[model samples]
Target: MTPEEFAATFERIRREVRTVIVGHETLIDHVLTAFIAGGHVLLEGVPGLGKTLLVKTLAQSLELSFSRIQFTPDLMPADIVGTNVVMQDAEGRRYFEFQRGPVFTQVLLADEVNRATPKTQSALLEAMQEHTVTAAGTSYALEEPFFVLATQNPIEMEGTYPLPEAQLDRFLFKVKAEFPTAADLVEIIDRTTVADQPQARVVASREVIRQMLRLAREVEVASHVKAYTARLVRATHPGDPRSADMARRYVRYGASPRGVQALILSAKVRALVAGRANVSLGDLKALALPSLRHRIILNFEGEAEGIDADAVIQNALDETPELEEART
Candidate 1:
């Protein structure tokens, strides 16, 4: 697909989603970016913020299999990745059979993901990273265009297991779902209370989504632009000379290499969606926060002081220059 075609299709999908979703334009954009980038998204918000509704709307707007997994403390790995079971055929022969779980679908919605125990949560690690589920020593490949959109309530920590760092790193972007404005809330109530409720129409196909992913990778990134992304990620480390003052003071660990990968790929998608043939500095800058926030580990002092990862990321962005000066 051409860049313009990609942008048009993206906008169409966004418009379709907006039909049912009241607001949260930024959240929708990040989720769509991750979808086209072939990456997963982690959405953090309180209950009743329409996080689940957003994922469902996206699924309704696309032609793909959708599955919703309501994560809970008692949820198990087998409940998520399927398990081998003994079966009897019509011929009276007994054999082992694998029952596919919700993870087998094209789009998986892990609602309140943190509510599940760590062991149960680890079940998705392999699928998210490799797109394959291994059960009873047998490997099952998930359907193509597999995307996971997980939501967790940030206000409630009781009885919830925090996602491990390794698992957290798997998500390409961690989007914060902000509450709706007064006008948006009024519109939401009107839509829900009235007899006529908005519904999202299917606007894009799996094939078109695949094409968009291909075109996004085809978007060019200049050498200096690539170097700038690398520098931005490097500056997150507290010990690195390139590290910003905020990072050195508040950050315990910097973002991983995957963070850099996410930034570049998302920026490419952002550029394509903006009808640009190549990624620009602004694209990278705009993506730095969502791409690196969850990846950065804060120090105890920073946590005690209630430091925000976004603040530290902004510091890095301010201190990191676009290019290194040439030798005199």
Candidate 2:
């Protein structure tokens, strides 16, 4: 599809989502970018902010199978990726069969994913990165357009095993779901308190989403912009001169190559959604945090100083905004 066609399809999807989802337009847009970019997303928010509802609505608005797994401490890898079992046949011979898990769906909702143990969380890493799961020395490929939308409660740390950086790196964006404004809250109440809640119509199919993904890759970017993306990610490292003293004090590790890839890809999608055929520095600036927030690793100093990964990423963006766009 052409860029305008891609934008039209996504706009319809967005309107469908807004029928039930009242607020958080930016968060919704980031999620859409990740979808078209063929990347997973990690949503951080408190309960009752409509994070789950948003993902569910997206699932409903697309022609895809949706599965939701409520992650818990006792959840196992086998519980997510399925396990092989021996079954007796009519001839009395036993045969090994695989029972596919919830991860087999095209769109997966891992609710409160941080509640699961690290081992269980790691189970999703292979699927997220390779779109396949290896079990019993056999690999099973997931469906095309497979996407994982994992949510976590930011306020709750107790009994939660934080996602290791290795697993965190698999996601494309770390979107933060914010609370609704008073007007939005009133609208939410006005809608929910009544009997009828708007339902999202299926606006796009798997083929459309796939086409959009291909179109997103064609969004042009200047060579300097590409270099700037790489430099911005590198500047998050401790010894980089562009990094602030606070970053050097607080950062344990910088983002990986995947971070730069996500930064560039998501920006491209953002530009397409805005009806642009080429990525702009403003696109990169707007997507910096969601693309790199989870990628940055904070040191002990950050923990003690009460500085979070978001702050470090924001500082990096502030430092690089001028330089990143100078070529433009």
Candidate 3:
């Protein structure tokens, strides 16, 4: 698909998703960015924020298999990656076969992912990064356009396990599901609390989505934009000379190279989805928080002072060059 066509496709997805989810347009945008960038998403929100509904609506709008796995503390890696099973044939010959887990689907919703143990969470990292799962000394390729939409409750929630940084890096964006405005809440109530819940129409096929992903990758990004992205990533580190005062005081460790890569890829996709042939600094700024939120580590002082990652990223944006900001 051309850039213009890709933009139109995203509009269809937005319309379809909004039918079921009343608000949270930013959340939807980040999810779309991850989709085109071939990266997974980590959704953090309280209950009743429509995170689950949004994923379901997204799956419905695309013609692909969708599976939901509710992660629990007792869940094991074998439960997610699947284990070999022994079976007997009609001729009495025995052989072991691999049974695919819920991760095999094109869109996998790992609900309350942090509730699972770290081992179970690690089982999905390979699939998210490589789009394949290794089982029983054999590698099984996942379907094209594989996406893992994992949700997590707030840290205060009991019996929850925090996702390790290594596992967190696999996700392209860590979307925060914000509450709806009063008007949106009223609309939501009118739409769902009454008789009918809005239904989504399938707007794109798996093939069409793949084509759009290619078009997003084809979006041009200038050297200035690339440099600006690198600066944003670097500013997350406390010791970096270019880091802002707030970053030096609050940050523990900066984002890795993967964070910069995710930021640029997401920016390119965002530009294409907006019908732009090239990536702009605006695209980078819009995605900076979600791209770096999971990657940046907080210092003990920052945690004690209740300094969130968003504040540090905002400060870093202020340190970015005006020439780059204007281009965005």
Cα error of candidate 1 at position 248, Å: 0.9
Q: After aligning candidate 3 to the native by TM-score, how far in Å is the CA of 154 from where it should be?
A: 0.5
| Candidates' C-alpha lDDT | 0.91, 0.88, 0.87
| Maximum-lDDT candidate | 1
Off by over 4 Å in 3: 322-328
Write one digit per residue (lDDT tens) for candidate 2, span 41-61: 999988789988999999999
Q: Deviation in angstroms for 49 in model 1?
A: 0.9
Which candidate, 1 or 2, has the higher lDDT?
1
User: Estimated TM-score per prediction?
Assistant: 0.97, 0.95, 0.96
Superposed model 2: Cα runs more than 4 Å off: 321-328
Clashing pairs in 1: none
| Ranking of predictions according to lDDT | 1, 2, 3
Error of 3 at 80 (Å): 1.0
lDDT of 3 by residue, 212-264 (tens): 88777777789878878877887788887778777899888988899988998
Q: What TM-score number comes out for model 1?
A: 0.97
Candidate 3 positional error at 272, Å: 1.4
